[model samples]
Target chain A: MTSALGAGLEPTLDALRARRSGIMCKHWETVEAGLCIGEVAGVDDVVMRADLAHYACRNNRLAQLGLEQDQFAAAVGAATSRYGRRRIGVFLGTSTSGILSSEIAYRQRDPHSGALPASHDYRHTHNSYSVAAFVREYFGLQGPAFVVSTACSSSAKVFGNAWRMIAGGWIDAALVGGVDSLCLTTLYGFRSLQLVSDQPCRPFDAERNGLSIGEAAAFVLLERGDAAAPGNVLLTGVGESSDAYHMSSPHPEGLGAVEAMRAALRMAGLQPEDIDYINLHGTATPSNDAAENRAVMSVFGAATPCSSTKGHTGHTLGAAGAVEAVISALALGNELAPAGVGSTRLDPQFGVHYLFDNRSQPLRHVLSNSFGFGGSNCSLVFSGAAP
Target chain B: MNGVRLYVDGIGLHAPGMAGWSQGCEVLGGRAAFVAEVPPLAAPQALPPTERRRVGLPVRLSMAIGLEAARQAQVDVATLATVFSSTGGDCDNCHHLLDTLASPDRTVSPTRFHNSVHNAPSGYWGIATGCRLPSTTLCAYDATFCAGLTEAVSQVSQTGEACLLLAYDTAYPEPLYALRPIPHAAGIALVLAPKQSERSLARLEIVPDAGLPGRMEDAALEQLRTRVPAARGLPLLQALARQQPAEVVLEYLDAFHLRIGVMPCI
Candidate 1:
């Protein structure tokens, strides 16, 4: 996993432990949107592999960087040896994808005929399936592959898609994750919607105004439960739902969010009290946090420890689900609940236990929530193997 | 990981010359001559006036077929999960946004920004039907139709429920068109259920195969099949229209294609 927090899992956990914020105020690209962004460092310097050069773009570069870290590629190699290349699938998520390539290509269009440059490759870069195609080609996998682009819930819902594929005997394993890069479209687009925060976002805080946009590439190798070893984290449940309410705004009462959580619990055959920690999808937007709080309060109440790691990573948009799922896995592996940085005071109306500081505990089960534009919502449950 | 078996309870199709499922069957069944004329797409009645005005061609094309299939299946639209697949979603809107962002004043409209998401049609589907069921939007370039079929059929097989698979693509305008030259707009929707029902049109057994995919006999129809990603399901639909047990392979990822065994129920 790579994000504004750091390049890999260890650095991410270290930053979470230290409560360090990776958001910085700077001008990104040519857009003059003066808002703090959680930009992944050194993305500009990333070069694509020779064979995969055609897939070169900020998004695929980020995905390649993520694949190189934590021996993730090597792990996938080991899985390939066991399951064979054709038995595994690639399911990824991205919002803007490499639209930056198109955005830049548009700037270089021929003034006379409005033709884009010859070097521009929309199929490999700007297409919604670009990242998945890159990853599939990188690993030389020949199984089913596609990209889920339902905004924020994209990556989280990939877990469900992978689960169904595996359950339905389509693939033995899946490389499921998300990669979203910094682009002018999101920067200017969110600003247009008045959902960009000038400072680091304070999720669930009374003064919370909006979200701090971020970019990240996070991946997870999902195999059957029987393949897990002792102490290994297992994806127990995944619930997906739609608001059926609005495009940008979440349901006021979080009706869809509640259904997602409940459905996940039902799938896991566990109750709400069984969950040890909650990774809130707190984008820091006033309405989003409020609606999620209502949903969480109704489901788990105020007893469970919960925090939005977005305070450290910023909302990574489509990648937020996988990023936070990684954080939840880290929490279960290390037996600690990370702090919700940036937010100074919890909102009075929010009745849930919003963690303000890091806490150490023997965590067993954790729930990570991710909701997105177009009223898409998904929740995942991860648990440590029984001792 | 062998394959899955499900029933196609209903089908909806919209493209040049083919207006809906009955019309599509007539052309595919050779009962009617294949015409290569663009058909007018009406705004989905499910959408309110405000949303109807805001949506572009992709949304209209997808919703038009989705509603048609759901209505044909006589299922509750509010609870049926949907899978929307498109190679390029809202291409016109994307071109407009790119044009606006490249201009001197880079003020993107909020509505356009929200609608630019690949799932805009899925989101609007939820609002249109007031269905809180889970809806997934995905893309696989030209392999989108097969990918969506795999996902939707897997969902039905796993949950023992009905799922709607909506595949559609629209042309990109101007300079963008020069890059991705999709000729016309087309969409196909299939309401799949785990078990055969009174409305079952065909039973499909889908497995991955390396065999060559079937193609349209008519040159114009075959051209549509190859040019538009969503129309890749043409051969399979043709088999269903023939009302005979047949095997039809559709293009999928890499070297593998989905070999579907179609057995008509009625």
Candidate 2:
């Protein structure tokens, strides 16, 4: 993992046994609250996914705790009101943004019009920088705004980059998160992979076949140590690894997974068993679950409590890490081992502990893993205390 | 050790100009446009019938080159990580969708939409390859060649096995050509691993180059030509098969030139 790794960097894992407090959390129900878009382009003549996103983005009806994407400035405003407006930077990750817009615009094309619709500007909407621009403009942020496009690791890498930027004195405060609306590209792409289950995926289950596609957008406000160091969840460590393996295949031995996990542990200065709870990248596919199982057993043994929440909202792709990042912070705050929604029974072949159901326990530090295609692996360790 | 390295494990590409890269870098001897023959407004990128065109060429090239590099590494892909870098994304369809939207009545192709995601090819690669290892896609423009190459080398150093680094770029369509301002197209790969003294071909030497950031790219090909004149017409693909590193350089907009040092580990 250090082939191109710079110096003075470390990365790790933690165990979440199970306990209780309330900071905030995001569940499917939260997406139910209608997000009224002032104006939209096409697909309006009839109803479409982008149209109902105001209230139809989530799978379950679990209420999420974060602010709406459109209210990005309000979230920043909320943060600034408490800490006093400081230089703000923006970082976000996404699989597909405004792609729904593109789809809608295309569907409304005029045969002889000789031009596509103007509602969703192809250049602005498809460039991947639109969301970055949206957040920067909304909050009047001038520090730095970058959109990370590293497939699923996009959001986790955001935290990593922001940490470096802040440590390097590039910004005093920043807002980091991700947002990706569901689109046909994702649904069909998963279908092509044959990785998409006919139904919602059952992660870590012996009978588990594939994953369910979902959409989400989330963010978090990060600030450097300042007045009183607001006892908020502290960003602890991040580990990134590249295995140069095949475009789609992972090393059967979990070579890069081990390195990423080890790096995360090194960054946190902790051992494998030190982790309290582990949010796995269990996409429910045969290869992924088995490979991850091997990695966990080799490191933390079979006693660690592990669970995958993919059952709740499906796989959010790039936004998976960001949504799960917020979930980890909330986990530390609430001290509850979220119910592993998909898995019915653990694969007996793997001895590592699998959270069959949700449990409440004392939590400290948790490890969140988000791996992407093209052999990019990223692991994040979050703690309640400052490292 | 702090310097950068680039290698070729395999190759996957579909351009109007050519097929497979072999040793000697001669495979790229006559560079031309793959977009010109694509007709006035061709359909989005096509794939083998079995695979279909569910993925655009931008992504297809990434996966092909990525898989080819892994095959070259002679390692099981189920375990290694991947780093995919590209200058442009599945833009052909993106533009197509835009043109459709520009119509008085926007009617988009669901097929076009599905093939357009940046990760579409990645998802297909994962499902088809069945490796299940984590994958990452990055964008750094022309400099992506360096950023991605260095990143993979870092991964190999960090992991001690190998890393697959795929860099690809596709030109815009006619409409986009009329819009954007650059002539761009390419697909390249490297498998970076720990240097084996006995198998090592060449050692990569990277300095800070504060005064000559872009010099690495400027001097790479020429330096290789000077050192191995016999490779002038040698196909990049054949060279890779014979275990050779094709020297190449790229100049960045910011003058932060990146030289892809292909040291051998045969």
Candidate 3:
């Protein structure tokens, strides 16, 4: 039963009378307009674009933030203000810290002595903690500022860190987010693993190829219930688990994945049936989809509606978890599920329910899952209800 | 509380000075710190130039530290868990990608993209060591010390399998290097055991400080050493690894301060 709003153009709020609550995805990106949407070969309109690495430095694992030193500070200005001065801390997650800068320096070196070029700036922004430092100085945040680079699960862990701080009475507010731009290093790295999808990724599709890499910078304002404004979503729970199975593959049984989901449910004091929707960490790769689907079914049975937004956004790597989390919060507040843009036919392999097209209704609880290459799994639960 | 168990059973480090745990540990007294010098690769000629070009400092560091610790802990690849952690991950690679894309001509290398995933080091560790047991990588901002330790403890307790914990961070590259990080320390702490061993080395505990609020990882490490006279750990967690017969205690402050209780191997 959903709520009725203005004659109920969409599902009415009353329709949710017996449903209790659901997770709504509000502001979500279905595809990139300016650039090619994903890794498809024949794009009708990608007015302007270039190959993944031709765009930047290559080979080296570490790379700098593509942002101008000061520009990064400016980009986070609004967020710094929102979190307040003393209470703000910067949490960043990355896979490579400053490999690109090193690559450029390596290329420009005095090849003979292996010395860096005169133009090289040794203070590479690609260092893991640079973003936190930039954000800290950007907003003059005096509190503890740091970065988390846990492979794919990097940013997802940021939510866990922030929630604990708020719950444990650390800072009154926190600036939690992630930023990563594409680099040849990442492209080539994934290609080396034979995991990069040559075409735009199809997350749960049986015919899915691989992952179409993408990049983004996103942040969310996390405040306590006492300090939060009306309609602000509550960061109710964060669950983290390690597979200790394979470095790049999830347990075939989804043991670690299930543990993480269970932990989040326990911490939130909620049951699987209590969740309204799930934002999957579906990378569109055959392995990831297979593993994640098994895990989702293991937990949600078949009733919980689910969708892998990665098809629409491409796997943003470090930024994927945070961006999806932001989208989840927006959905809860607006009570709308952004239709799955790329998913044509539901993957027959996965049995969970998916919202077709776009729909508006009452939403309360949302579970966002971020599973990285190392089996570092984090599930963050966001709630819209007052409690 | 007699015979507080503390032993440097296995240690792995990635610093400018050395890559082996025994070598780095002997030099630093089991301390994790910034490396001032990076020696030439031990097997420079063995690895193809492409392999050298493909690997980053962290991955190189992980290999050096991982193999050594594997030897020290008598780690069997078939039955082990590894924890990989860094305050920041391959940002240099990410930045390069961004700069390239932002440039008039956007082109990033395919090789670099693969290296950009946070799990690169762990993947390489598995590839290099042929260790298939489960593994994970984590980032806790500056709290890498506590977060890495907690995850390691949980793995050993939950799975009861041998686990290798590697935590390290390198200096930021340039343009960005002009920025600041107290010190670009390449530190790796390895904790191991088989399935919550009946024979515990030191019981690690997380105690929160209700009064202090959110402190950094170092503070938690410092408090644990302070609470227990012999429970001294350096680089924040060195104290836990060195826990003595005395009731060793360490405190960690994240969003909330956690007091870690370590039960030394008797």
Candidate 4:
């Protein structure tokens, strides 16, 4: 994942362990929210190869940077060699897509004619499937590919899609992840909704105001369990539910969230106590944190340790699912439960055990939650292979 | 593992001259004529007054077709999960939002922002039906229909539950239209069951292979299929119209086309 916390898994893990946040107060070009952002630095400097120039855009650039990090591309290549390109599916998620590219084109319209610049390649760049198409071509894979754009739950749902496809024998292996880059629409749009915190986000804090909008690109390679090494992590279960209560607001009591968690637990065939740590979808917004807390408490009780990594990496919108999934996998492998930065004091009303400091312990099963604007909720369960 | 076989019990479609399943079947079977002009989409009665007014053509068409499929299948909409796929969801809403951002005012309305998410249509469906079942929204550009089919088929086989698959796309306005030119609004809905029941209309076997699907005889119908992503479901609609067993391939990934072996139970 690339954010203000630096690139790749190692630096991100180091930042999380050292309690170094990536969010910083910086004014975006046109946005005046004054809210801190978790923008990936040097994004403009990162360019695509000449052959991939057709897919050039800020979003794809971030995706390219993400692919280059942590030897993720190498892993994907190895999978391609094993499963053959035609047998590996690509399922990615994104929200704004390359709308930023369009946003730029809108400014460069012909002064009199109002025609957009000819350079705007909407099909290959701005389309919702652009990232998936680009990745498929980048890795030279010809398998079934699509993009899931259900807001923030987009990426988390990829795991479920890949799992179902593989289990049904549609594909031998799959690349499931998301890449959502920052753009004016989300920045101003969230600000217009009054959901953007002017300061760095403080999830679960008593004084928490709103979320700090961020961008991220994170992916994971999923194959048959037999192909994975003994110590590699495994995705045990995925649970999804639509709140159907509101378009932008979650259920007041988190009934949908509870259902999603319960479903995941049922799928995994594990009890609440079986979970070691939970990466909360704590976006730092008042209603979001409160609603998620109710859901977590109802499912895992106050005993299960939980924290929102948004405080560390900021809320990466559609990419949060995969970003937090990577964080959960990193925590499981490193045996370090990341603490909630910036939330020095948890809200007294929330009954869940919200962690404020890192804990060094043997983590076995971890659950990550991602809920989105349309009340779309998805929870994923990941287990350490050794344990 | 062999892919699970699914029964397509109900089909719904909205296009230029094809309004409902009956009309679509008629046109596909050469009983009714095809037109190339864009038709006005009907608003879904299932939505509340507030949502009915707020939603655009995409949501209305999706709901209209989805309800028709559910009705034909003789199942409660509340009992089924859904998978909604579109190449560009609510392009009108996006164009308006982009216009607002491009304007000097820059402040967007809460409703517009809320409706901007690609899954807004799925969210509205949930609200209208009060169904808490899983609903996923996906896109694969022009291959959206086939991708949605793959997802819905996998879901029905995995969960042993009936699912509604809706693939829809509408035209984008000027500036953006010049780039990705989708001329007309179209949608296709299907009610897929894990096992064939008394209501089953046809059976579908989805396999991975490569080949171009047979072109529609009517130049207008073929034009619609080539231009609109959702209209790629035309071949399946035609098979349903024939009321006989047929085999056809649909666009999927770059190297692979979804080979569907269709059999009409009636």
Candidate 5:
């Protein structure tokens, strides 16, 4: 994973353990609105390989940076050899999808005719499927590939997608993840919606205002359950739902969120009590945190240890699901309970076990929630390979 | 990947010259001439007035085709699961939003922002049909149609439930047009079920194959196969158009194509 919190899992885990945050005051070029941002440091310095020059863009650059980290490429290569490349599918999620490249191109259009600059490459860059195509080429994999762009829940839904294909006897294994880069549209668009915070977001706090937009890239490899198990990690269950109640806002009572969590638990054949840790989608926005709190309380009864890592990494948009999925795995593997950092005082009224400090505990199954615009909602249950 | 077979129970189509299944079948069969102008999409009356007013071309096109497929299959729209695929979702809306963001004001309208999500069409489908089942939106550039078919087939096989695959693409306005160059709008909706039913039209199975897929017979339709991402399903569409057992291939990914073997059961 590459995110504002820092690159790779160790750094992100270390930051979470130290209760550190990566958000800073808004400073992105062309984003003048007074809002905070979780900028992935040194993205401009990351360069794409010459062979894959056609896929060069901020999004793919971040994806390459992510692949280089934590031996992700090596894992993919091993899977390629086992599955023969054609048998492995590539499923990724993203929102902006290199629109920044076009945003830049739009500025360079001819003064009079408005003709875009000759250098524009929409297929390799701005298209939503660009990242999946780039990853497929980067690894030389020939399997089925596509991009899921359902807002923040994009990445989480890919797990369900891969599960269906693999379980239905389509693909033996799959590469699933998400990558979203900071762009003017998201920063300004959120600001226009008044969902941008002036300072680091304080998720689930009474004074919680809005979200701090962030960017990240995270990937995972999934082989059939019977295949050689790479590690002790397993994606046990996934559930998806559409609120159908509103466009940008979630269902007021979190109807979709409740159903998604319940459905995931049902699919995993586990009860809510089996979940040792809950990674809240807590975007720090007033509506999101409140709605999620109600949904969590109704499901877990305010007893389960829960927190939002968004305080550390900021809300990574489409990548938030996979980033948090990794965070859930890290917490289980390291036997640590991540805390909601930015919230100095948890909101007392909501009455959920909102953690504000890290603690060591024996973790087993963990659930992560991701909800997005268009009322798209997804919940995933991940388990350790141990008893 | 294993071969997952699904029965195509119903089909809905809307394109420049094609309007519905019968019309599309006629056009694909070379019995009718291709028209250059795309048919105008009507605002979906099934959707609430508010949502209907807020949607753009993608939503309108998806709803029109999806409802038609559901109606033909005699399936309750409220019980359907959907996968809506598009190369560039609501390009006009994107262009409008980008144009607004580029200006000094930089504040995007709420309606435009909400409708900008790729799954906006799926959301409206849920509202119009009152379906809460899982729905996913996908994009694979020009491979979007094949990807959607793969997903729909997998969903049907995995869950033993019927699934709807809606593939559509719209032309981008000027600046984006220079890059994508989609000359016209096109969309296809298929109702796929796990097993053959009274309404089943054909049994379809997709397997991986080497090289590009089969092409349309006419040059104009062939141009559509290249221009519109959704139109890449022309081979399968033509097979269904003929209402006979046929083998067709679809472009899926680099170095791989989806070889679809269709056995008509109508």
Candidate 6:
């Protein structure tokens, strides 16, 4: 995983343990919005591999960077040797994709005829499928591949898709993840919606206003867990639902969120009390946090320890699901409930147990929540392999 | 690899000269001559007036086909899960946002900003139908239709429930069009079930193959099949129209094609 928190899992764990915030007030590209952003450092300097030059863009660069870290490529190579390349699939998630390339192309359009530059490559860069295509070509895998683009819930939902494909005997394994890069469209677009925070986002804090936009690339290899190791984390359950209420606003009572959580628990054959920690989707927006709190209370109540790591990495948009999933795994492995950075005080109105400080405890099962624009909601359950 | 079997309970289609499933079958079955004229699209009446006015071509196209298939299958739209696939989502809205962002003002409309998401149609579908069921949106460039079919069928096979697959694509406006030239707007919707039912139109066994993909016989239909990503399902639709047991290969990824064995039910 590569995120604003750090480049790899160890560094991300370190930052989470230390409760360090990666968000800073900086201007990205030409836009001077004067807002806080969780920009991944050195993304502009990333160069595409020679063979994959046609897939050059900020999004692919971030994906390549994430793929190179934590010996992920080597792990995939081993999986290839075991399962063969044709038995694995690539399923990724992204929102705006490399629309920045088109945004730039639009600026460089010919004034006379309004023609775009001949060098513009929409298929490789701007297309929503580009990241998956790049990853598939990078690994030379010849299996089913697609990109899910359901806003913030995209990557989380890919887990459900991969699980179904594997369960259905179509593919033996899946490279499931998400990659979203900083683009003027999101930065300015969120700004237009008045959802961009001027300071580091304080998720679940009493004074929280809105979200701090961030960029990240997170990937996880999912295979059948029949022959799993002792300490390996296993994906137990996945639930997906739609709000059917509004486009940008979540359902007031979080009815869909409740349904998704309950469905996930039902699939896992576990009850709400089985969840040890909850990774809240808290984007720091007033309505989002409040709605999620209602959903969490209705399902798990106020007993389970929960925190939104968005305070550490900021909301990575489409990548938030995979990013937080990795974080949840890290927390389970380390048995640490990382603090919700930037949130000094919990909202008094929130009935759920919102963790404001790091707590060390024996953790077994964790639930991560990710909801997005269009009222799409997804919840995932992860548990440590039985000892 | 063994093929996965699924039943097609209903079908919806909208393209140039082919407006609905019956019309599409007529053209594909060779009972009627294929005509190449722009088709009229009406706003989905299920949506309220405010939302109805806000939607663009992609939403209208998806809603038109989705509602048609659901109505034909006699299933509650509120309970059916959906898979929406498109090469580029709302290209016109994207162009508008790009133009606005590039201008001196650099201020985008909130409605346009929200609608720019690839899942806008899926979101609107939920609102219009009041379906809290999960809906996923995906893109695989030109192979989008096949990809969506794969996902929808997999869902039906695994969950033992009906799934709706909606594949559509609209042409980009100007400068962007120069890069990726999708000629006309087209959409196809299939309501797939795990088991045969009273409304089952056909049974399909889908498997990945390396064989050459089937093509439309008519010149105009062939052009549409190649130009528009969603229309690549033309050969499959043609087989369904023939109502005879047949095997049809559809374009998937560069590595392999999807070969489906179609057996008519009625």
Docking class of 5: medium
Best by lDDT: 1
- In order, candidate lDDTs are 0.93, 0.55, 0.57, 0.89, 0.88, 0.92
DockQ of 1: 0.88
**The best candidate in terms of DockQ:** 1
Q: What shift in Å separates residue B194 of candidate 6 from its native position after superposition? A: 0.7
TM-score of the A chain in model 2: 0.79
lDDT of 1 by residue, B1-266 (tens): 46689999889999999999999999999999888888899878888999989999988999899989998999988869999999999999999999988999999999999999999999999999999999999999999999899899889999999999999999999898887899999999999999999999999999988778888889999999999999999998899889999999999886878999999999
Q: What lDDT tens digits, residue by residue, belong to model 2 across residues A68-174?
A: 32355565787666544334656677666555555554556556853445443543454454565555554555444556676667877777656655654445677
Which consecutive 10 residues in model 2 chain B have the weakest lDDT in total?
B225-234
- Model 3 / residue B239 / CA error / Å: 7.8
Compared with the true structure, what per-residue lDDT tens digits does model 6 show for residues A1-387? 999987999989999989999998877788866868898998878888999999999999999999999999988888888898888989999998999999999999999999988888999999999999999999989889999999999999999999999998888999999999999899888888988788999998999999999999999999898977988899998999999999999998999999989888888999999998999999999999999999999998889899999988888999999999999999889999887999998899999888878999979899999999999999999999999
Model 3, A182-270: lDDT tens per residue?
54456546765778665566677767777767654556656666665668788887787766555567788887788788888887899
Task: Look at candidate 1 and tell me the lDDT of residue B241.
Answer: 87
For residues B130-162, could you state the per-residue lDDT of candidate 4 as single tens digits? Answer: 989899999999899989999999999899999
The alpha-carbon interface RMSD of model 1 comes to: 0.8
iRMSD for each candidate structure, in the order shown? 0.8, 7.0, 7.5, 0.9, 1.3, 0.8
* Stretches > 4 Å off in candidate 4: B1-3
Which CAPRI quality tier does the interface of model 6 achieve?
high
- Quote the true-contact fraction of every model: 0.86, 0.14, 0.27, 0.80, 0.74, 0.80
Off by over 4 Å in 5: A228-231
Per-candidate total of colliding backbone pairs: 1, 103, 118, 0, 2, 0
What's the C-alpha lDDT at position B82 in model 1? 95
Error of 2 at A86 (Å): 9.2
Model 3 lDDT tens row, B37-101: 65554532223455555777677766666666666566564455677776545546655665554
Which residue pairs of candidate 5 clash? A170-B1, A170-B2
